[model samples]
Target: MQTITSARMAAIDTNCEYLGIKRLQLMENAGAAVASAVKERISSGKVVIIAGRGNNGGDAFVAARHLGGYDVTVILIGKKEDLKTPEALHNWNVLEKTSIPLVEFTNSTFFDPSILKNAKVIIDGIFGTGVRGRIHEPESTIIDLINGSGAFVLSVDVPSGFDPDGGEFDKAVHAGLTLTFHKMKTGFLSQNAQQYTGEIRVVDIGIPIEAEFYVGPGDIQPFLKRPAISHKGDAGRILVIGGGPYSGAPALSALSALRAGADIVTVAAPKNVSDIIASYSPNLIVKKLTGEILVEDDIPIISRLIEKHDVVVMGMGLGNADETLLAIEKIVPLCTKAVIDADALSPQLVPFLDKNMILTPHAGEMKRLSGNDVPDEQKERIEFIKSFAQKNEVTVLLKGAIDLISDWLEVRANRTGNAGMTVGGTGDVLAGLTGALFARCKSPLEAAACGAFINGAAGDMAFKEFGYGLLATDIIDYIPAVMKA
Candidate 1:
């Protein structure tokens, strides 16, 4: 039941000695659990266990020992001489005594399809949590072969060739079932991981409960729970103030806020655009403001609207104007918590920094906020952004190849999006999502981190079907998928 990140798993491994379990015993338990799962699934099928040179392969070897009565074969991706860990070598020695067929992958010998033609189950052990970079040529070829074979593939620990924590791999094994050890890795929950791992099963290998206590529970619980007796107003109210020429943008933001668990959503737009926004979503309560663009005259009315809502989302599709700048200055100071994005992130409004506020700015908007003319380099930008957020006592989410979220305490990097999110209005959706969470969250920093992670994950999910053609609306559609119970 423990939901842990990859770093937490590594910490468990490093602190195993203190938990009173040897590494060898943990590996044994892992293999036995996997073997039990295999035996339950296919009683007498021809089993082909793909073995690497790591501990993951060692688990496969142990499973082969238990499956000796059945028709089983082990395929080692590398030569026997290249075996790394002591546990892996010990398992290999024990497996060699059995009559089960063994094959070493090499340039001279071609992988015979006949070996796996009748195999009812295929075990993937090519790589595991320790895998880094892209899958090399031969491994990529192996993954392709496994995928094309149409066999029921079961991956041990994790699907081979996938990164344990972050980053995308060139190729990975598409497993019908994945048997992960101890705790679930962060990659197991990602949209990209779903492409390779069909169904995930976590095996508890007798790791101490203290192992989980070390990392503490993840911060996602607050977003997952629902109160049974709560009403619409109790959940939280969100006010979205943006929409003029780009009418669809504000609607997208408002809907996303509702989708991200906001109970009541109100869109404040010009009279001409309010009708269009209201027509798009019946859940939205649109308030028709007097001006086409948010002006100074609209500030008093906007402040009154902000009082009813728990949080406010500003700056999506807000056209740049002197009146807009003045309106933002007055409105920002009045709201308890606000999410500022798009044209509302101008330098003129930088002085009103509230720790309760979150700013969702893309690279260009970030440059405007920081008044920096430098080119985009991730490390340099993150450092500068952290300094900016700390100086202002606000949370800033800098959107780019990898999203960097910062406040005074810490900087968390989110690597969960595809290039498909470059479409317009996605930022508006993100701003709305942040605003929704901001209403319920204890701090602005948590809201920002959770919002970025959830939004990027939704975008990643949308990218799977739509690929590069993913629209902003597609991201909003998949928000429920990412935020599933």
Candidate 2:
């Protein structure tokens, strides 16, 4: 019984669209399922559905049409034109043609508590799993009224005012039965959440199981939203801390970060390579360190710089010098979020592995980090990486054919790149892309999963144009196209 979290459910829904299953079809199936579930418990009554403006309300609209022999009425808490999603609004428009009594409550204080007093089976569709923070306005009042109405309550998806992720809120609708679509919520089994969730019912809404185990364009769909009033640095600010022995490595990483939708990228490197890195691209901001390589004296300033950025990319071109690894080990804990790559994959950094960090390592680095050789067989490789990542409580993106990504419990495998991707500097592009996504994604595991998919997809795109002559820069150029939803 794999419980789906709110974030994972969103990914699965997007994958359904990518697989050509229309959103309207899924909503129709969900509404039909709710109608069947309601009929099994209460055959006839003055059924009142308190629907919000989201997709949950759309489900209620569909259910109202199929609830045979029942008097169904819809109470929409917001304006029908102000619906949140396109599918929800479409259903609302269709409901207008039916004879179902439609009651609109636009403001918080207008709806009367007596409206639901006669409800024998009140459907609670006021809020779904998408809500966060405290409950406000007419919805909060509605939650209380539903709890006290003494009606046989049925919640669609999640109960109104209840956190689907299991966090306790101020007020929540206490329902007799809850019909959740697809799979059971991960939080529904929490301590007191079942009290409000009642008898949990998992309904199949026709989403393919392949969508749950694979990575596709749907994984990056959340990054496509950009509010018009958003300012600079709102997208992401990344700091690249590398480039001592190799001049080109840090520049490639910094440039790739900018191409991956990061608003700001700063490359802080040794003095010998700082000017060369800055001269390669005008999009990067280069900061010069005191020494030619990472050293003990640079820890204080690097720590301060780590605090300024949203995410940090460390160890691209910083050769495996003793002093360089030492600097990496010290500065990693200071970062808010990070992508640890290249020469910094020292075994000493194992203690620093956690949910906030992502370690992108090739076969050799994986061997060093785990104190074992890279296994030849696919199953052995997955078990080794999965076990080690779980033990350390960190997200590991082990780079190889059929890239394995794990955060101890859940693992995602990626198969998108070609043999032409076996070139130098391609991994650096992956590291920078991981950094840019880590700043915006919900978790480190999600960012690393997206990184592997996008980086490999871009490599395949470049390989088509250049055959075996694909340069690392060619992959970077195709990233934006692959990232577009």
Candidate 3:
């Protein structure tokens, strides 16, 4: 009964592989499910598979292999060389070695509508959930042909051409049945979706629970991609407010923010530590605030800086002085979005937990703010984190051996980190990484979840060579590698 967005489904698929479930194995299961669905409808006939050059097509190829004795013919909507995924290409290679009739339509001119006239059942695997916007070329022509053919049409994943996220389309296949995978697509719940989807069956592709529940490489994919024509600050412009008691923490956060793909990172530190923080990196833009520590007088200048930045990553090493805490109270309300961490995680900030803030807290800090101990048991901890996020209406990134991220509605646990990450400044790195992601991400929970995953995964990579000697700076150095992965 649960529904997932196509984007989330793709994330889950990638996570499944991260957990050792290969794409080929999932394709086999999906195809077998499609083949079984066809058999249930009608045993034997001239079954025509209309497939695209992606995973949807791969599923059709697997189904064709499974329907061995039946008269199955596969019509690939694009050239074999154009198959998009390795799994799709692998299945196509398998079909090429078989005796099944195969047809390839590389262009619009190659389509033959009359070919569908005699098809007892048409498997529409042209465009699963990935497609959006206007229908193109052979796929457009083929959709019309399949609709007019009057065959028992079974669409794979989703009705081809239907926007599985929005439930709108330029044109789509009118399937008699839609064999969706893993879960019902969110788009199918729309009022008009049933016209194209018909009877829908949610197919299980054997995705592990860890894939959906845990943060992995899949969770960060959307954030890593950039538009070709993006401007300088399109990634993120972060304003880090820390330092005073210690300079290293804020500098680490600022450096990690840049390493995590933030375009510009500025550090606002007390005049004494400002030079020291700036000396750590030539890249950082340091704004020196007056006095030994943050005070109410610095609020005006900090407010101006906050307006210029996309997100405020605050409280890395700004100690718990009363004047400094009062300054934090004023500055936090000014931030449109913030990643609150370290000494900044105070009960005074609770009233301002307006869902725009991401709170990253270790066990002691979390207990300080929530007045409750973080349970050792994972289930109880998850519920505790979720409940806190819901009640506060804020995103919570609880840092521990198992990082827990929650935005009330959904809770994701990240298991990418290790014992080596207990290093002092790793939490600062995570706070900065989270600030970078939160600036661009639509969901605070997603940004926190992916940030935790990236921070820990990078730590894991650093641990490979550095072992227990892994430093927080080492984690920052490997951020791009983790993103690339």
Best by TM-score: 3
Candidate 1 yields a Cα-based lDDT of 0.82
Q: Which TM-score value belongs to model 3?
A: 0.97
Best by lDDT: 3
lDDT of 3 by residue, 172-228 (tens): 999999999999988898888889999999988898888999998888999888899
Per-residue alpha-carbon lDDT of candidate 2 for residues 241-314, written as tens digits (9 for 90 to 100): 99989988888888888888999999999999999999998888998899999887888888788888999999
Q: What is the C-alpha lDDT of each candidate?
A: 0.82, 0.87, 0.92
Q: How many residue pairs in model 3 have overlapping backbones?
A: 0
Question: What is model 2's C-alpha RMSD?
Answer: 4.1
**By descending lDDT, how would the candidates be arranged?**
3, 2, 1
Candidate 1 lDDT over residue span 1-485, tens digit each: 44555555665665575456677788788888878888889879788888898888888888888885788889988888878888888888887887878888875668776777878889888887878876775677888889888889999988888776756777788999998887777777777678788899888888876444322114444677788888868778999999876798889999999898899999999877889899997889999989788888887788888889999898887788787788888888898888988878998878897888889888888888888853578768768878899888889988877777888566776666788898988888899998888888767877887788788889988989899999999999998887776
RMSD of each: 16.8, 4.1, 1.4
lDDT of 1 at 427: 89
Off by over 4 Å in 3: 108-110
Error of 1 at 40 (Å): 42
